[model samples]
Each structure stands twice: as C-alpha cells, then as structure tokens.
Target: MQGPLLLPGLCFLLSLFGAVTQKTKTSCAKCPANASCVNNTHCTCDHGYTSGSGQKLFTFPLETCNDTTSSKTTQGRKELQKIVDKFESFLTNQTLRSTEERQEISSTVTTILRDVESKVLETALKAPEQKVLKIQNGSLAIETRVITDNCSEERKTFNLNVQMNSMDIGCNDIIQGDTQGPSAIAFISYSSLGNIINATFFEEMDKKDQVYLNSQVVSAAIGPKRNVSLSKSVTLTFQHVKKEDPVLTIITYVGLSVSLLCLLLAALTFLLCKAIQNTSTSLHLHLSLCLFLAHLLFLVGIDRTEPKMLCSIIAGALHYLYLAAFTWMLLEGLHLFLTARNLTVVNYSSINRLMKWIMFPVGYGVPAVTVAISAASRPHLYGTADRCWLHLDQGFIWSFLGPVCAIFSVNLVLFILVFWILKRKLSSLNSEVSTIQNTRMLAFKATAQLFILGCTWCLGLLQVGPAAQVMAYLFAIINSLQGFFIFLVYCLLSQQVQKQYRKWFREIVKSKSESETYTLSSKMGPDSKPSEGDVFPGQVKIKY
Candidate 1:
C-alpha cells in the first residue's frame, strides 16, 4: 500500500515542479523557442508557453507560424497581422511606447526561435500600431523599426485613455450596508502602473434617490513600480431629502455681509476691548476668532496650492476648535453646577485656573492625538477631503465616540444631581416648587447661559454625517457669536457692566455732535479713550 501511494505522489510532485519551472522560464526566463532539449525532444512548447499557465506569445512548440513550402509569406503575414492588431489594442498604460519596449519583447522571442534553426518574427512600430516580420518558406525577412520596449507583455499591461470629471462622480458604491444602496463607491484609474492607490469610504450620497452632490474624498500614492495613482472615497448612512430644497454655493453670500460684519466686530471685541476680556470669555473669543479666520483663510487658499493641504488643515482645525470650545463649555457646566449647589455661588478663581489647563488636553490634545495616531498608523489618511473624520479603526470610537458618549452621560448625571441637590435643599427654603422660584430661576438662568455658551459648539463631536461643512458654519456663528453674548451677559447684563454701559450710552446719546463721551472708567481722564464721534457705520465701540 505504501509503495503504491508513494509512486503516484512522486509522479504528481514531479509534474507540478516541471510545470512551475516552465512557467517561471516563460515569465522572464529565456530558452530555445519551439525547441526543447528534454529527452532529446526537439519541438517542445516554448519554455513556459504550454508547460503551465495561459497562452504565451512564443510558446516553444510553435515558433514558426508556418513551415510548409506550399504557403506564401504574404498570406502568412496578413494572418499574423490580424493577431497583432487584435492584441495590440489591449496594451493600456504607456503614453509613448519607445523602441526599447518593442525590442526587448522581440529579442526574447527571437532568441528561442534562432536556436531551433527556424525563421523568427519580430518588428517594432510606432506608438499606435505595430508590424511583424515577414515569414515565408521557412525564411525570415524584417522591417526596420526605431522604437521598441514600451509595450507590456502581460495581458493587463496595456494603456487606456481615461477622461473623467471629478464633479460628475457619485457615491453609490461605498455605503453598501444592511440591504441599502452602497454607502459610497468610486471608480478611478490612472495612466501609470506599479503605483497602487484607492479612494477612501466617506461622504453620504445616493443617486437612486436622485441626490446630487459630489463626494469629497482624496488619496494619492506612488506604487512599487513608480506608477502614480490616486483615489479618494467616502460613505455614510443613507437619508432621503428634497434635492431642490437645498443648495450650497458661493452665491450663498447674498445675506452674508451682515453675518460677516457681526463676526468681525465680535472678533475685535476680544482682541481690542480690554474691559470685555477675561480668561473665561477669552476661550470663546479665541474659538470664534479661529473659526472666522479659518473660513477666511480657506476662501483665500482654495485653488492656490498644488495639492491644497491648507484648506484641509484650516477645516480640520475649525472642527477641533469647535470641540475645544465645547470642552471649555463643559468646564463652564461643572463650574455652574458648583455655583447652583452652594447658597452662595462658589468662587471660580482657582477652578478656572485648573480648567484653563484642562481645556487644552480635552479640546486640543485629544483631537490632535487621534489624528496623529491615525496618520502614523496609515499616513494615507491625513488631510483627506472627506468631512471631519475619525479612523476606521474600532478604537477610534473610544477616542471620539467614547468622549462624546461619556460627555453626554456625564452631562446627564451632572444635570440630575444638580436637580437632586436643589430639591433636597428646597425644603429648607420652605417655599413651594415654583418654576420661577429663586433657586429654580437661578438654575434656569444658568441653563440658559450654558446653552448660549457651549450648545452649538457641542453639535460637532456628534459623529454625524458629512454635515461638517454645514456644521462648520454653525460652529463659526455660535463660536464667534459667543464672544459678543458673553460680553453682553457678563459685561452688559450684570449691573456693574450694564450701569457702566448705560452711563456711557446715555452720555453718548445726550452728547453734542461735537463732544463725545467714553466708557473707559469715569475715573480716567477723557484722554484715555477715543472721541465719541469716532463711531462709524456698522462698527461697535465699547470703551469699557
């Protein structure tokens, strides 16, 4: 039994080895064309042509197209021309085929045939079409050609002209999820080979639903053979919406002047108005300033760079700033909770100090770290055109998603505890549970401030779809507008800042056109501030 089994196994192994060696020789190995030395066999198929895999250009067993004396060379040439024409259409990547590519392949086939004493066929033509050597009566005659070595021998090693518009692309292929249309899909090809690249999964779009918005995804790489290819893609959960009900365009600037002016003044308030500045409000001011500046820079930077990393950097930073502001707002919540619980509000001097430090890591550190890790793990992920992104890695959920879920949970607990503490202490005040009661009113006020301060900023980090573009504008408005709101609240809503504002407002209101009043502390001299007449249209001046 062992002898019988061993015999078949050895034979099978030998045949497989012979097939592999022949295939390898065919791949790049050179041997006599149409001639084999195996057991004195003179006409074995080309080293690799018939021994193993697919068809070979010069399979050894058939080097000469015709060896009969009855056949005419002209007819054989036409037959060979047909095969060359059919296959030449298949070469797809070279822009200009040099004589070198054509020559190398010719030499490989000729070397094998000359060894068999048979006529060889070889010729190199121009980039578009090629010609073959005339073979008749077992003799060879060739045409003189200049360019060679530019065509691929492999079946897929051909050139294809691809012309596509980035705007006409759709996301139907990527978002393929549980029985729905593709979350997103992209098809891209390059004019170069040996370079591997593909589009990333991002953006939420559906053409079956008649939605039209180009997905924004970008990736580029140089493959092993120095072939250059680039791909970008994005995918998201499917949602249906009216196509005409929305449009985002540069023309959306119709009413943008007012928003821009307000944002500018809001920005200047923190930068120039010392009386309105503080650590607590400064964070909001910086956030607002960054957002406005980022948008402004983006508008200027687009179409300016070879690759456009600045727009992406500004965009990503804007998102990071939004979250940072929210981190600060979280700090605000913790602070307000302490204030509401104590009959006397807690002093925030030290806590604010600690918070100032904490916000950097919570707001800046986490996003930065996550981005860095993702880029290092796979640098192809950096500065993608896809909307605010997280890594595809599962742990990325823990970085951003974990924080979001944790923050929401913490907010819930803190919110409940705030009410619980208030209710327990409510009995001591011996008052009915009036919605507008003193403590309740104060809590409501705090809640309102929290909403005014951190609410919009928190909308990011929600891990939603490609809404970052829209959410980015919202982040800018809420973020930049917060500076003005904070100034109005702490500086104008309070009696101290308000009395000061009111006194100054009245003085200016009642002043002579020639004489102006200022708000840089009444104790200071008139020389301490700008003249009241200095007021200009659309410009806000708060001296104090």
Candidate 2:
C-alpha cells in the first residue's frame, strides 16, 4: 500500500510541473511588445504603460494605456477640451481609421481611449508622429511617439498616440489623513524590468495645481508619501522639464570644496596653536569639526540611496551632525556674549569655567536626544528614494527645522544684546577719537559675528514666491561657504594666530639655513672638518 501511494504522488508531481511549464511558455509566447511574463502566466506591461481598467499594464485584448493631466473639480476643463478637439481634428484630417472606448475603472475616474491605426497600415509610410495620454489619480500625462510601428520585422506592430482631458482624480482619496496638500510627482518604468520608479518634481505649470513632465516620465503620484494607498483611480500628466541647472551644480561643488579646505585648515590651526587655545578656540574647533563631518558625509553618501535601511541611517546621521554644528554655533555666540559682558574685568576664569560646564553637554547631547526621539517615532520616514534626508511628509521635517529655528532665534537675541553692550561700553570711553575707532571696529565685528554664527540661514526661511531664486542663491552661497568665513575671522585674522604663524615661520627659516650650512661643510670631504677660520671663535669640532 505504501509503495503504491509513493508512485501516485510522484506521478502527480510530474504532471503539475509539466502544467506549470506549459503555462509559462504560453504566457511568454502571447506577451505583447514591451511586456513580460511574470509567475509563468501573467503578462505585465512595461513601466510607462497602464491597462485600460487601471490594472497593471497587462497584455489583454482591447486594453489601452491613457495619459492625462491632473484630475479635479472641473477647473481646467476648457483648456483640456481644446487639446481634445485638436486631437480629433488631427484624426479627421489624416482620414485615420479609429475607434473610441470609454472605461469606468473606478467611481472617481473615467478613462477614454481613441485607438487610431498606424499610418503604415494605410500606406507605405513610416508611423505618424503621435502622442499618448493617460489619466490616473487626477493628473494629465502626455507622451509623443509612444509607439513605432513600421514595416520592418523588428518594428512592425500597432502603435498608439493617446490623449486624456479633464479626468476626475478624487482628491479625498489622495489626502488620506494628512492635512497638507499633495505634491505632483511622476513615475517611470524601469528600463530593464517591469517595476516603477518615481521621477518627481520634473516641472510645474504657471497654474497652482497643474504640473508638466516629459514622455520619459510615465506616472504622476501625489506627495512624498508615495507609499500611501488611494481608493480612487489617478490620472498622471507628463510634460517636458529642463534638466538640472549646470550653474547650480557648479556653485554647490565649488563652494563645498572651498569650505572643506578652509575647515580642515582652521581645525588644524586650532589644534596646533597653543597661544590661541581657549574656550573660544576650542568652541571654534568643535564647530569646524562638526561642519566638516556633516559636509563630507553629505558629499559622499547622499546619493547612496539603494539600500533603504542604509539611507535611513545616513539621514539620521546627517540630522544629528547638522544639528550639532548649529548647536555649536549657538554656543559660540553665547561664549562671545559672555566675553563681551566681562571685558571690563581683569580675567575670564569664571566665564571659562561656566562655559566648560555648559557647552559640551548641550552641544552634543541635545541633537542626539532629538534625533533619537525622531528615529524612535518614525524611523521609516528618515529617507526617500532620491534623498537621504528626513521625509517632508507628516511633518517629519519639523524635527530638523524646529531646532534650527530655535537656535537662530536665540543667536539673534544674543547678537542684539551684545551689540547693545558694545555700544554702551564705547560711549563710556571719554576720548572721542578712541570711541569712534572702537565703534567702527565693533560694528564690523558684529556684522561678521552674525554671519559666522549661521544667521544667514534666515534667507532660507524667507525664500518664497517671486524672489525665491534670488534668496536661494544668496542662501546657498552664504551657508555653503560658512567654513571659509570661520577660517578667515577666527584663524587668519586673529592677532594671536598671526603672531604665532610669524614666529614659527622665522624659526623654520633659521633652522633651514643652519642645516644647509652644515650640509655644505659635511659634503666638502669626509676628512674635511670645520676649521677655526670657517667656524665661529667659540665653536669646537669633535671627530670620531
């Protein structure tokens, strides 16, 4: 009985394998161009295409892919209707045989497909330059020359140019639980496979709600929360957007390079120069170190977004490091204010002790705790597919922005108070000439101090509306070269640092001259020793 059962099971397994193999072959054999078989039976469309019923682009008869603009409450219908008329006129003028189909895939979306025969079918002509439109999730997407159907064996296939207008993308489904508006993002199919990749922020129209993208951009998604699911169908719009600006790229890389060099030099100077060793220099050193690490990590690992977990870790690190740098800047401002307050005193020993007690714990510990809290709450939102930084969705970016704003506020207050104190002190001096000179010096230092302490980040907050470009450039140039300013003000211009450099330079030259003379005397000959005539009167030579 056992042997009989075993034989039957083996036969059943063999039959099942054969059936699976046959199904796989059938799916692949019938799969359409630009489509592939998955799981041995299902044929999936390539990245830029979608099925008629809003399913994954599948190889089904009568299935048509549609591109569309944004879906909504009939605001932009007039413009879209004009485009539709143009499409119909094109079809009529060409005498192209076509069929129209309307699909109600969901309660919110209606997909319309106007299938026009290829020109190659009518005459011995190349395929007409056509455009394709798809509507899903309340956006309009247009694609030109979507299909190339010609007579050659490699190219002979049905091609389509589709257009969609005024499709409804239910806004209720897109917003989900979030109160903020959704962002318009585009999705494209992977070149080598059937998966989708989001290519967001390609371009925006002059109108508030509409976006424009290219044919290469296939689907449009709402918001950074791409993972969110929606109950209704979406229509994506595609239009051409300019590539990344070369000028912006040039500014960023060049500024970062100069900042890195200056930071490294400043750090070295602080470490090696004992004369400048104090609470101020120590604070500057730590500030430079934090900024250096933050910048270096960003430049190297920002684009390493492949492994999701690693990208999240990088985002967390960046969050902590940048916060720490800003915290140190805050500490620097506090230290300066303290110094200014106590300038009338003979010594700063008390202030030094007080700073030592306060600076380190606040500078390093606060950012760590904040980051830890943020990570604990929503670690998954730490990074996006394209950026290894905090997600803008669900107010996660506030974790960074909040601390920066607080620090900036505190620093600004400290700056104002310091200025007031300086003004009062200058007024107290009896000599007019001395007071004028001191006032001038104080004014320059105050301006430089505000910039050095990361106050230029204010420009970032003010970047809005028409002047956004001007503010953006100013923000980038000022903040990116902060390390250079620190080096210039704290290291190069400091009297103590300059004196130390000059002292070291003279000693180095004197030592080099003595070594050269010694070398010349030795190279005269092995037996040649310094004589009384060659050497100073007190010099003596010993030979062994």
Collision count for each candidate, in order? 40, 37
* Top-scoring candidate (TM-score): 2
| Runs of candidate 2 exceeding 4 Å displacement | 1-243, 430-443, 526-544
- lDDT at residue 234 of model 2 (Cα atoms): 61
Summed over model 2, clashes come to 37
lDDT of 2 at 23: 63
What's the C-alpha lDDT at position 191 in model 1? 18
Report the lDDT tens digits of candidate 1 across residue range 1-544: 8999999999999999999767655543343444344433233453213433232333354243322222334444455455433323322223422233545534533443232221112111111122222221101112211113222232211111111112221111111112221111111221111111111111234546643434211211111111222123322222211122233333223223333455565656556555656665565565555445544543444334224355345444544554454455555566556645654434656656766777666656765675566445644322323333332222433444455455555655666677777667665765445422647655664666655654654765542567856665565555445445654554445444455557667877787432432333343465665565555433456453
Q: State residue 333's C-alpha deviation in candidate 2, in Å.
A: 1.1
TM-score of each: 0.41, 0.55
